[model samples]
Target: MQFSKSLMLLATLATGTFAHPAVGRRQATATSAAVSSDWTATPSSGAYSTAGFGSSTSSSGTGVTYEGNVGNPYGSNIIQISSSDASQYKYVAQFTGANTDSWTVAIFNKYGSDGKMDGWYGQACLTFTLAAGETKYVAFDDDSQGGWAAASGSTIPTDSNGGYASTWGEFDFGSTTNNGWSGFDVSAIAAQNADMTVSGMEICDALGGTCSSISPDAATVNNAYTSAETDVGGIGGNIASGPVRLAVTIDYSG
Candidate 1:
């Protein structure tokens, strides 16, 4: 379905980031049921599925678990930390002598007219401060209803659309404060009929813009963040330290 003029305007105003004026139109990829999720770390040992982060070290931990199917073209990319375990695994601290003390975790999807992953169609960045031995949970999701943790003292910020809803099937990590963090819910925008290409996830400074393009044909296991770029969103207020870690999971039906 074509986006209404009002909806497009709302997106332009809400993000303050406009879509590339020259985006080419292309056919959407075929829907698939083959789903998969992967996890990665900067130092290789900072995250664990069980305890999360490092088991021996005192640094904070970060991880991504998948829920839902990408085979459903109109379905939502539901990747988030559980609200039930929000208190146990939301915000995390950086290990001493690690890259940076802060982090910006995000999920990115590419859209192009070439029927391939082109430029970023929708992206969400969750920025947080991490101190040694401190664990905090920050919730985020691609759903329109906002899949964040409200009881965790976090809430999604109101956008130009009035509430925390995704217009162009976008994703969000809520606001950059504790109060904002408490308002997270599992609401995502439906894919509708938009054509999109799934790009792998990445961890970088909280600054906006593109970081690196992960090859979708790689091993599909645990790929490290590489070919980093510094000029993502042009020095933003939400900046993170160096050496950000990101874990990504992609579920698609072949």
Candidate 2:
């Protein structure tokens, strides 16, 4: 289902403004750490693999595109990671030719027993067009949280759509009570034969401190995304159902 820009526009009228989610107040002090790495590959029939992670199937869509037949098609299309270690890094995944229907960019995290997202971090989503052989970069930030919150007035459709427009929004994974997370969940159902290819993926440590970057410690991305998806909702929207590929990225601070 296409996003109701009118609805979004109406909501905008309330405050007449759109904004990014607010971050936690506690400013864990630190310096800027660089996280420049790549993990780009086509899934082997719905299976995702990284340097140190397990394999999971997509149920429907493999690699980039999918028929979106099965129920909950976007169940497990992420690189899993284990725990948080000192060497934790950043991760990112880009998509090219994504000028079709709707698309989503999300980051999922599995919290450890300690009540915090063990190795979890943050994620981002962007919309762009390709220029005959040109590619675009869609990245995620593992250094922060609060990207999964829903954008104001925007409702997730339970069906499908043919196109989507560009708009700034936010998402909230349930509430603060739930250890859910925050990340981008972009939906673009615009039908325009375009080729979207994810160029790279990386993971790193947090920016302000030595805290967990992508995850709390050394956790891999595969595990991180899976853990988070367990509670993720409104995936591909109401109209568009089943099997969607969510382009993602991992940020590391080494």
Best by lDDT: 2
Expressed as tens digits, the lDDT of each residue in 120-146 for candidate 2 is 122222223233223333222221212
What number of clashing residue pairs does each candidate have, in the order they appear?
46, 87
RMSD of each: 19.7, 19.6
* Poorest stretch of ten by lDDT in candidate 2: 63-72
Name the weakest run of 10 consecutive residues (lDDT summed) in model 1: 57-66
Off by over 4 Å in 1: 1-75, 83-100, 110-116, 119-122, 125-254
How far off is residue 193 in model 1, in Å?
32
Q: For candidate 2, give the lDDT of residue 154.
A: 28
Q: Write the per-residue lDDT of candidate 1 for residues 91-114, one digit (tens) a residue.
A: 221111122233222223222222
- lDDT of model number 1: 0.22
- Model 1 TM-score (2 dp): 0.20
